[model samples]
Target: MIKSIGTDLVKLERIKEIGIEKFAERILSPKESVVFKTITNELRKLTFLAGRFAAKEALFKCFKKGDLTANYKDFEILNDENGAPYIESKYTKELISHITITHTEEFAIAFIVLEYAEYK
Candidate 1:
């Protein structure tokens, strides 16, 4: 059963101002970095980051982190073979029920569904 669900939206321009390279390195995985490298406009890059940030926040909402602080890198956004973005959390791998992310030129969004599963 779905234990938790979350969704977030972010502005493209706001993320663009933060510098794509810096934000990607800090928040994205190595594979995600490669994808970000292909973006030409800062707005697009921010849009990608915003989607990823939202996904992470959604993941956090899925679990019981309590007072535990979360690092952005703790959950990396990765692309599937079909080039769809998905969540990859090494530490809390078992609790996720499902995740989805979407982005547009003006905004990015993500949703996460959590299940009551064991985490290693």
Candidate 2:
């Protein structure tokens, strides 16, 4: 069964001005941090951070309003060998999540859908 849907968009330029290291520390999980550190190209780094930030924001919106307990680091967005992104977090482990992230030179956008098993 579908539980919730959320979407967010982030400005690439704004993230670029925030400084990669600072932004990564504020949002990236331990494993994500390692990936961020390994990125050598500045554009790739900015897009990576922006995608994660937007994804987390979108996921947070999936919860009921006034639920602000989730921090950016709590939701880790990681890519598989094929470069498909997936969510890894205790909060979302039981729920199936689907995410689509896209970016241009100016903006990054993400859409998230949460689902749970249906019992008959």
Candidate 3:
């Protein structure tokens, strides 16, 4: 069964203005921070930061009503060998989550779907 859905859109320029290092330190998990630092292109770096920011916002919206407490550092977004993004969090063990992130030159957008399976 589906539990919740969340979506967020962020402006690339806004992320750019915030400064990548500061924003990454504030928002990205330690693992994500490493990836952010490895990117060589300026625009790609901004887009990457914006995408992660939007994704985290979307994930927070998914469980904001629950008793769970979340912070940007609590969740890490990781990619598989094929570059498929997935959430790695101790807080979401019982819930299954799917994330999709995309970006244009001006904006980065993300959508998260959370679900839980019924057990007999």
Candidate 4:
């Protein structure tokens, strides 16, 4: 069953102004940071950073993080062999998550769907 849905939009220019390297380190998990460092193109790297930020923000909207606070690092996103992005985190063991991210010349947008299932 569908548990929740969330979406987030981010301006690419805003990401640029903040400096991709600084933003990437702040939001990207250690594994993500390693892949990000290998990218040779500035635009692709920026887009990657923006997409990750938007994705984390969207995922944050899917559930509450309790009274402690929200930590972007809690959600880790990675791409598969086909270049499809997927979520990897200890927090999502019982939930199924679907996400899609897109970027234009000026913005990055992400949509997320969270689902719950029972073992048969």
Index of the highest-lDDT prediction: 2
The better-scoring model by TM-score among 1 and 4 is: 4
lDDT per residue as tens, model 3, 76-97: 9889899999999887778888
The TM-scores of all predictions, comma-separated, are 0.76, 0.93, 0.92, 0.93
Which residue pairs of candidate 4 clash?
none
Ranking by lDDT: 2, 4, 3, 1
1 or 2, greater by lDDT: 2
Candidate 4 off by > 4 Å:
65-70
Could you say which candidate leads in TM-score? 2
For candidate 4, the 10 contiguous residues with the lowest summed lDDT are 63-72
**lDDT (Cα) of model 4:** 0.87
Shift in Å, residue 73, candidate 2 = 0.5
Candidate RMSDs in Å, in order, are: 3.2, 1.6, 1.7, 1.6
Please identify model 1 stretches exceeding 4 Å from their true place: 38-44, 64-67, 117-120
Alpha-carbon shift of residue 34 in model 4 (angstroms):
1.1
- List lDDT for all candidates, in order: 0.73, 0.91, 0.87, 0.87
Better candidate by lDDT, 2 or 3: 2
- Residue-wise lDDT of candidate 2 within 13-106, one digit each (tens)? 8887888788888999999999988999989999999999999999988875635677989999999999999999988877889999999999
TM-score of 2: 0.93
Q: Candidate 1 at residue 96, lDDT?
A: 58
